[model samples]
Target: MKVTKEEVAYIAKLSNLMLTPEQAEKQAEEFSNILNHFDTINQENLTGIEMYSFEDEPLRLRKDEAIPFKNSDELYANTKSMQETAIKIPKVVE
Candidate 1:
């Protein structure tokens, strides 16, 4: 469960992040602690526990419907970034 600084650095690179050495160390400690917490949960005894089921009552999902909103102009007017009808977002993919 010991997350190394190298692993954190690799993950940061994959995520397009530029983290300092201090930040990477802090992230490594945080990740290791999270893994340790999961390890503690896995060690719990769960014998003779009746598993909960939803067979008695089936969930009913409502039909999806599109309702037109009238105040969209006010919402779109607040943002300066726009590309025709859609909002212009910054490209993040490397």
Candidate 2:
């Protein structure tokens, strides 16, 4: 799983990346380490692990209830601009 400088250059060329020699060497080492780590993980045995769809406990949700509030007419009475039941703003497009 060791990435060579030539391989790194090839990959960079395929990806349309322009890397300096030093950067290509560094990236090659990084990519090699990542591949090695993935290979190590793939060798692990997890036979009885349960797949989690969510956290252990179920989530608690608030009840849907409508609450009364002050009327919109009184709220918008002090505003300079308003429409039938909404705030009005100046048109930006011609």
Candidate 3:
């Protein structure tokens, strides 16, 4: 799983990156090392290992509480322009 400089350059181009020749070489070597590590992981024996499983009982989740902000009135009061409940802003886009 050796990564080449050309492949690194291609990846850089796809990711909108401008890598120097040295940087490309370094990245290629680093990527190759990463692939080698993956290859090493693939060669491991985990036949006796059990997969993760959730409990039979339903998962308990915290209630989604809505805490009201008290300073909303003060925020709107400081604004010069407000439409109804929301603060008004000038449109910048066409």
Candidate 4:
């Protein structure tokens, strides 16, 4: 699955890319190598492989606990504009 210069040019044109002659040649070589790697992988034998959706063991998650913040007012003390409980930003559209 070799990518030719003409193929690279066509791809670049379709993608709306501005590629120099050198860049196009380099990209073609890289793309060809990637396709060759995929071809090599397709030649492998995986007769009894188990597909994994998650880790083998169940994950231990932390218990949900409410932790009170100390000096919470300091976080919003430097705001230029704010409501009673939230920061305010200017409207973008009229």
**Top TM-score model:** 1
TM-score of 4: 0.42
CA-lDDT, candidates in order? 0.90, 0.87, 0.90, 0.87
Give the Cα-based TM-score of candidate 3 against the true structure: 0.45
**What is the per-residue lDDT of model 1 for residues 1-94, given as tens digits with 9 covering 90 to 100?**
9999999999999999989999999999999999888898778898887798778999988889888778888878978898767998888797
**TM-score of model 2 relative to the true fold?**
0.43
Ranking by TM-score: 1, 3, 2, 4
Question: Which structure is stronger by TM-score: 1 or 4?
Answer: 1
User: Which window of 10 residues has the lowest lDDT sum in candidate 1?
Assistant: 83-92
RMSD of each: 3.9, 11.4, 7.3, 7.7
Q: Quote the lDDT for 38 in model 4.
A: 85
Clashes of 4: 0
Name the 10 consecutive residues with the lowest summed lDDT in model 2: 67-76
Q: What's model 2's lDDT at 84?
A: 82
Backbone clash total for model 2 is 0
**Counted clashes in each candidate structure:** 0, 0, 0, 0
How far residue 25's Cα lies from its native spot in candidate 3, in Å, is 0.6
**lDDT comparing candidate 4 with the true structure:** 0.87
Each candidate's TM vs. the true structure? Answer: 0.63, 0.43, 0.45, 0.42
